[model samples]
Target: MSDEIGLILCPEARYNRSPIVLVENKLGVESWCVKFLLPYVHNKLLLYRQRKQWLDREALVDITCTLLLLNSDFTTAWNVRKELLQCGALNPERDLYLGKLALTKFPKSPETWIHRRWVLQQVLRECSPPSLDRKEQADSDLRDSAEKTRLSERLHRVLHDEMKVCADAAGRYPSNYNAWSHRIWVLQNMAQGNLKVLHDELSSMREWVSMHVSDHSGFHYRQFLLKALVRELSQSLHHHHAPWPSPGTSSPCSPSPDPQPAHHQANREATAAAPCPSPATPEDQSSVPAMPQLFHQEMELCTDLIQSFPGHETLWCHRRHVFYLWHHWRRDHNHHDGQGCGSESPQLNHTDAGLSSHPHTASPRGVGLDRVESRNGQAQEGQNAMEVDGVGIPDPCDTKRLKRGPPDPCPPALPSEHGFVASVLDGCLSPEQGCFALAYRKWLDSVIGQ
Candidate 1:
């Protein structure tokens, strides 16, 4: 690669080599450039660059496949990806190598779309090219066309099967951007008249997204579901005299239940004197916005999750989307607050220990610097005292010199509070007071509550 590209293919070309120079006491900007740019380079080159040349095609295929799976830049991977496709090794029956590569690269490059189109085009071009007239030549051409068609059909079948696997895997890991985008690309290029499969695919994806509403990736997937559903619904509603009821409305044609309260619970709790529908229980509720009305329901569920598990960073991050939407609504309304929402703010009050609020500990010093620093200093003092007694006084020459004089004074112990103040001033902790001091009353109540 270096011979072809005009640089050392191995060590000199290895990305992130600058620190190596600093550590090994070597010189040059070439090493520094290599170190700084390793993250952007393809893993194929990164791995082989550490070794001598004469690499195997399979080695490049495996390395490129892993890079595609992990999602290195599309353009960088693009250069090596052709090797995987040509190696005749990344079979759909064995693994979803090309499918995953296509999926991961879709967001950043036209190359993914190009690659898929190429798969189809090459298959067709090889199998069914135009004929030239000659009795022997025409017969040979016909046979060649037949072989190409057969091969193309086989590859297309692999393409479809691998895409299904990719979609299923994406459903399992909804947070994966590459997986989700790839699923979309697969659906887009599916055989034109397979509406039944397309509809079923959309339905399955919706169910998966609904099952994991707390996941931001799932929420994003729901937007994709809505887009697919709208198109389908629009086609179905074309003959209607009235405008279609907002999505998932009760209709004989639609499979979904009416946007009803969990009526099953209502029936379970039936009584002659109290006949209203029972409220949604946490278990019976769908966390996802199954219908348009359910979007607000999902938002409320996210808010409830925050209140229920305030210490969870994941839940807090999930709740931010609701905050963002509310903020947008407020902005549209001349800065008026949204209903049931407080002032639009992004503030999140997390403690230094990553807790949303200070947890009550029974110790005199709360979850703050006092105890941490005190313990640190006591251990340090013990070590220092041992050093002074063991080494300072034991040196015979120093002892003889000091024997005629008073013993040397030991160094003054450093104040623990000063260190605490310094750490706080450095923006690592609360500057106003120690953790215990900042909310003393709350800490006391928490202790009592526990």
Candidate 2:
């Protein structure tokens, strides 16, 4: 045992060998690790099976921690730690710390992420009280409200710390799917319904996405936040309108009321056009900016990104989602306003003639190749002419007066958002760009055709 401890502590002695091999060869630690692990695991399984007292909590924790550090996918070890947590032998914070340490070694481990999620739920369950009983007295209601408020604050802190952990993991390993998925779960399940909090998160995410352009997870999270904001605005609008009956309302069976005068309609329109003050509280009856405007802003952000990363499939796919949602929203809004299918139609000129109007020309390499081909053709023609004239194929080096072909035509630029998308699709249609871009183009065409 002393030799095993020394081998673990001495970096020079541990060089080059795997940790398990070092233990097995230098100090014969495998049998010791298994000896300490198997009995504890068996005891826990027995207790779980027999529904008896969970004994030797400290020993179980020490053994399980060691085993898990060596092999994080050891489900039995994680189960033992969870039992320890339930039995009050281990605290939530300590479990979370252990999880973080394990994640540093195994960032992609599904078990580690699952265990962390379990710990978070345990923390939440302890902090928040049960929903108030309808039959309870007023005092119970007050207590429940206070407890909920406190719980919300604590949950906010816990989730904020977890977000930082996930962000760090993602930065270290950009393709860490487990870290990204865990962050999304936290946001969807744990975040409070506070617009200010959501807005701050949105600001942070904007910076993150800008820095990591190819991360689809970051972009997807942004979409989730935007959708959440839209839902909040909609709920607010519904609540605001629910209290007031329609202008001519009475009992449901009453005769219909007269239509409002044109002057009265004009006055209401004027009121709507004026700027309204921001609401003093979330529940106050104040109007949010129109939903289409929000979608338009997001669309503009996507356009900027697409321009910067012209060849990235993820960005293009995200843009497709944005457009799909935007079109649906517009359709709903127009229907609500009693307008028959919107006036602005979705159309793309899918012909080579349209390419002539695109502002950006073919890539420089393509243009260079065209120039080389034209020069070669002219040189070949001159040689053929010399042979026909019976000049005995004048010295090949003397054919230096080469005539150049007319320059490649410059295509005109398409300036609208649709035009930009169409141009990008055209550029990516080539085989070298891969199938993803082409498939997306086909999907876009179907959407426009609808």
Candidate 3:
């Protein structure tokens, strides 16, 4: 790309020629060229689009691609592409590929993500089955079943590629709001209620966030997945073990004992009376994943990360989220006694990993060096605070729940969010008492305590 043939003795950039820099399979166009090239392509594309000057589809596609790559923020360029998409001149997957390339450079480009979502919606709509209800599904013919399987496979491939695209974009830009938000959108729309897909995403993000510890967006995405899992488990547990009616209530049906032979009764009684041989028995290890255990494990992760990477507001914010979820979870459990719950995991003790507090509150407001995150998520990013796409954490100190401590009759003990926070402050000397730790404490007391 470096045009060096006619050098002006010093090999310097001039009006007609600019330098090109290449790094590891990536091309970097210097600003000298961008200043001129961008306006040329942009004006050409806009003029054609506005005046309907160029009805040539190939020229439109070519010029639009150049303009978008130069400035994906150019909404008119994206709209022109959308027009071509509507006319069936552009393939959805090809357009998606273009968006992926655009995101590689501009991972936080809202316009690029918006266009991508539109194209992805088309792909999803094409893959959806037509009028297949429960009865039809149950009695589907072999051909229909085969077609559904093929369509499912295609969707899975599309989602897998999209996940890769999001991951790459997230890596390119830390705390990438658009990339992570798009990731949430993909799961909610393409992989909704798919437990295995959710599990895989949770697994992959662990390694990713460990390396990018300060990524608030990544942590928020994790929050979104955890909520989905909680909702799923709660629903399943309710259906599987529906409560029995009270004996005091009137009943039309009679309850009769089984007429079993004496030997058979004796054998059943012998089996019923026998206790489980060991705590590790397969029967005792229920297949149901414990919701509380998951939360506790998440707590462990948060605390560990906080100690390891001191001074990151993202970690503290993540801690606040986990604590809020756990607190509300216990509150919810008390209110709905039979909600699907698992064996409680032990409290996450602050491992005095010799991690004493230090101070780094250089920024004003004592916010530390952590990246800023938008509290009110944008609608287009699919970062809505609703059940399906919600990535928000609840307020930890809601007073209604504070006054109504524990359930009516009370249950086994668990550490409160306050107790947990106190332990973290006492055990770890974050920053030798840095700005983030102190600010977090003040937030708990002044903001939350209020």
Candidate 4:
């Protein structure tokens, strides 16, 4: 089947061989024939791989598509396509379309996502401009610049399309691990340290997770974004002082994230900004939320989600990640400052399945979110009013002017993690039993010593 119409017809998650009505854009294959269809395609591809007289390259592509759309995890069939791709017999875009269609029914298929990543890397390579000599550049600077722009636009289009494909697969299957993982890989490979891309993703995902509260993978992707945002913020500062890489060459891509330069160093106790020789102007800071404000907004979101949708373990788990990241960021800052963790800090614990989380805490230090500083008015009106557009706005409820005793003690110190967990536990239906809440409470106690 041509990639332009490679959409799979299967509706079931399991083998992805269900029958669907044939359409202009979809592939329709009967499930009952899937049993006979696979063995036939398998033998035909085997003959082609063996270089049989009749089975040729076109026959190979035709049979592999039939095998993969039904069994998306067929590693050998994908490898055959990869061989074809390497031999210049197939286009990267065509293979990407094939992978997207394979993912339609088998959202969690490991090999399908893997092949997609490989194809994406090939696309990235194609997008990179060839190195040129100084004389060549001087001769055609405008042409070179235009060529670079074309490559950049092509890469951006592919990046956005891949993100959408991953989102759709994730939506089709809750906790679709392969989908989210591939999305992360694409960002790290294609748009590393692009703050605008990260911000856009976080904004769109906010609404997606709101609708799919039980999808743990969606929340996990959000956590990845939060980490990436902080890392990018810190990296921006480092890059400001560091010399740029040569314009003629592109940086080599890493398959996974590299060891970052202690990103949390700049974001202290989840409130303070990085101590810099020259502070960034307020206008420069306004575009990004203060680190504390980010955490506060996230905490508020967790509270609202838990209160609105009671007893979802995923919601409670999401809350755990928010606290865990906040706690660790503060500790990293403390370590950077030569002041060790205080008595209230969370002990190091196993995070994310069985992996050891490098440095993360699940508790706050000193004041809670109530007293945190703001860059975007995140419920900080009770604190000293911030200067706006060169004018320091005085507090409307200043005791000396309004005759009120005090501005109400900073909104009762936001709520301690313990208190927040207790409130969530209190709201759960008895039949629902709030097991997720109880588990989260136990997590707080064990990790944060709350």
Q: Pick the candidate with the highest lDDT.
A: 4
What RMSD does model 4 have? 12.2
Query: Which residue pairs of candidate 2 clash?
Result: 357-412, 358-412, 358-413, 359-412, 359-413
lDDT of 3 at 338: 30
Per-residue CA lDDT of model 1 for 47-67, tens digit only, reads 565665545767766656445
lDDT of each: 0.40, 0.57, 0.61, 0.64
Any runs in candidate 4 off by more than 4 Å, and if so which? 1-21, 237-286, 334-415, 431-435
Q: What is the model-wide C-alpha lDDT for candidate 4?
A: 0.64
Could you estimate the TM-score for every candidate?
0.32, 0.58, 0.63, 0.69
> How large is the C-alpha RMSD of every model relative to the true structure?
26.9, 19.4, 20.4, 12.2
Task: Identify the leading candidate in terms of TM-score.
Answer: 4
Off by over 4 Å in 2: 1-55, 131-146, 192-194, 239-290, 339-415, 422-442
Deviation of model 2 at 380, angstroms: 65
Query: What's model 4's TM-score?
Result: 0.69
lDDT of each residue in 145-186, candidate 3, tens digit only: 576667667777788889998998888888889899888887
lDDT for position 314 in model 2: 71
- Model 2 is weakest, by summed lDDT over 10 consecutive residues, at 245-254
Candidate 4 C-alpha lDDT tens digits along 1-450? 432223343444465434544566655565556667789898887776677846667877898888888788889899999999999988888888888887877888999999998887677666655666988868888786677667767777788789888998998788899899999877766766566677778878988988998998899999999998766654453334212111111221111222454433322222121111112343444456645556667777877887887767788788788878766654453343232222232223333221221112222322333223342265355353576676767666454647744422211111256566565566657545377777776786577643
